[model samples]
Target: MSALQAVAKTSAPTPEYYFQEARAFFDAFKASQAIISYRKSLLMTPAAPQALNNLRLLEQSIGRMPDGVKSATRACVLEPGNTALQHGLTDALLSAGEIEHGQARNFWRHLKPEILIIRQGLPEEWNGGPCRDGQSLLICHEQGIGDEIRFASCIPDIQKRFGGPVILESDKRLATLFARSFPGLTVVEKVQRSDSNPPTAQYRPLVEEHGIGRYIMLADLQSFVRPSLEAFPRTAGYLTPDVTETRHWKDHFRATGKQPAVGLSWRSGMRRAGARHNYPELQDIVPFLKGADFLPVCLQYDMSSSERTAIQKASTKQLYIPAGIDQRNELDRVAAMIAALDLVISPNTSVLMIAGAVATPSIGLHSERGATFLGAKTDPWFPEECSLIKSGDGSWSALINEAIPYLTRMLSKGGRLK
Candidate 1:
């Protein structure tokens, strides 16, 4: 090595030097090196919010939620007033499946007035309060499609424990599905126009108008029902699919004589920048479909015309998609079909959540960035039904390769072709 290069390498890196190095590594997509350099910067200046924040982002970008939780929590502690840091910590904590209610509540408590309009009209949020006999409760919806569904598993639990007439407010798109799933409960559309925090003019009517006694965010229901892994609902599946719809799908697939019908949803609609990394391309899933013993049925909701054409022309292997099924708009029917399937293979989208929630044996193929993936063979949320197969590296093919053997064993045991 040259003397000049050796001397430069041996010289101690200042906090600024390490921070710059970290930024360079981050720009180059060298996450490990960036994290190391950021940590070194923090060692020199422990309360450096920029270094801590960057470190947290790097960890989350690569699906390292536990590391992100620590990094984000430290950042929030170092700069308690920073809204971004607090929210980042909240997200990190949720991703790790550990509800940091205190942090979450604190973060929302300090929310700027301009952003509070999204949740403006709700009554006081219920915090595990004992239910008064015959009192009504409003369960408000928050977050994205997948999260809403994941937390909806708590609805039945609330009904069983709280023993009151419950009103559930969810996204307009999910109102029909939730109504069908949770029998004897009132389902209403959320006032918020979109998932974003910035308020819109179309806030839903206040709970007082509906005669609800109290209210709680849908996500908050977890604190009451699933405070820990052991407390999750024990029922085989929580969301109840329409029996008639299930029968229709069963008959539809039976007429086709598709053996061991397998459902597939290879993409995620997360929409965040670089979030598509969490999804597999139809081409990437083609390898698994090439030699599959089961009838591969397309369950992807947002499949575009071009994507559909691509899937049809991708390989010689035949894949089945049921006729006249509206995957996106008709959640109840789609969920019924999922329940009738022998197996569902998907990424970290609502499809996987629905399949697992219904007790349908599913294989969750996920990237390193899946917070719910949890790096375990079985997920804590739906341990009996959902088996997680995390990609060893970044390649979707690698994940599918590992999942194929597991699927084979599962099929041999009971998921055999009909």
Candidate 2:
């Protein structure tokens, strides 16, 4: 070996240097680069559990489930008792279709409990339990609104198996629609972010007053309810919007019955690091507004004036927003509006969840490989009406291009795509 080459080898950077490089790449929204740098660091130092865990999150977010599972499994092995790592592994397993394994259920035990409840309610429930009849099951609140709706897919299956009165703690925004849709569930209008600092003081009374004792986080029900692909109900949609409200929105759109009504959501409710990959800019969807076969309606909340003006400039006709409907707070009306539309188009946001729940024909543009996929090619929750275009490497433009055929089919005279 040359003397200069040996000198360069001796000055090679440390694993910690590569680790911090990965974190910076992720924070800058370069997910694929982050994954590569993380792998490089982990190769240099096998004991780096944080690097492994972070890599797993990036891989899974971009639909690389196999890589995600590998990284998560290693992280769990390195730190077996770490709640967050265990949770990460469980989610990786779930997304990789390893449902009945040791770590899939109650993984959120690592997260804070929303509220403490007395043990007297129903003590027999296991890590995974059999259906209990005539008992009360309190479905505790956790995560964002989108997650709540996605997990609610299990509600019907659980109800069928356990003939029990289910009490669901929901975001105040979702309470009305959830109540109307489930009919049987006692809906407590409230919001709680995991077992974290968020308080549930306003809705705790309903649990106590009803003598409800047993509580399960929403996602935990999956271990029993959807343990396998075949277990998911073959239903078009589960949530029922108010009939009159749906009719009202349908008529509002039908007035311009020349073109099909399409609801468009381009962003998430909250933005965070690496979130830009899951959404499109106002300019990105302007082409959709130019489509001749559909009338685009704005379903995006917290939209800026610049985006609104951009939409106005792009479309031959001005883009429409459903009047008097608060897209953020009035979720019941939002559900009805989604139901009324001939088609709904959005990124991997709550709009897709609501559209799926209401049985509306929808095309979802997603980059994140959410556990709701359950390792399937399409969404298992609402397979009949919801079609997902996943840009595995965070290419939203490519995903939008992928939706052309779906649009062509759904907009044709004889095709329902349902």
Error of 1 at 392 (Å): 8.3
Over the stretch 1-418, how does candidate 2's per-residue lDDT look in tens digits?
Answer: 1443454477885687677777767655677887888888888998988889999988887778888989998998999877788778877887887768733554555353432422222333433444354557777776688889989878877766666677887888888888887868888865432433543234355556766546777767777778788988776788989899999988889897677888888899798766766677677776666554777888898788888887787767677877897889898889988888888888878998888888887877777656667777778887645455554454566667667777778878422674
Residue range with the least summed lDDT across 10 consecutive positions in model 1: 369-378
Looking at candidate 2, the ten consecutive residues that score lowest on lDDT are 114-123
Most accurate candidate by TM-score: 2
C-alpha lDDT values of all predictions: 0.71, 0.74
Q: What is the TM-score of each candidate against the true structure?
A: 0.81, 0.85
What lDDT score is found at residue 10 in candidate 1? 83
Question: Which of the numbered candidates is closest to the native, going by highest lDDT?
Answer: 2
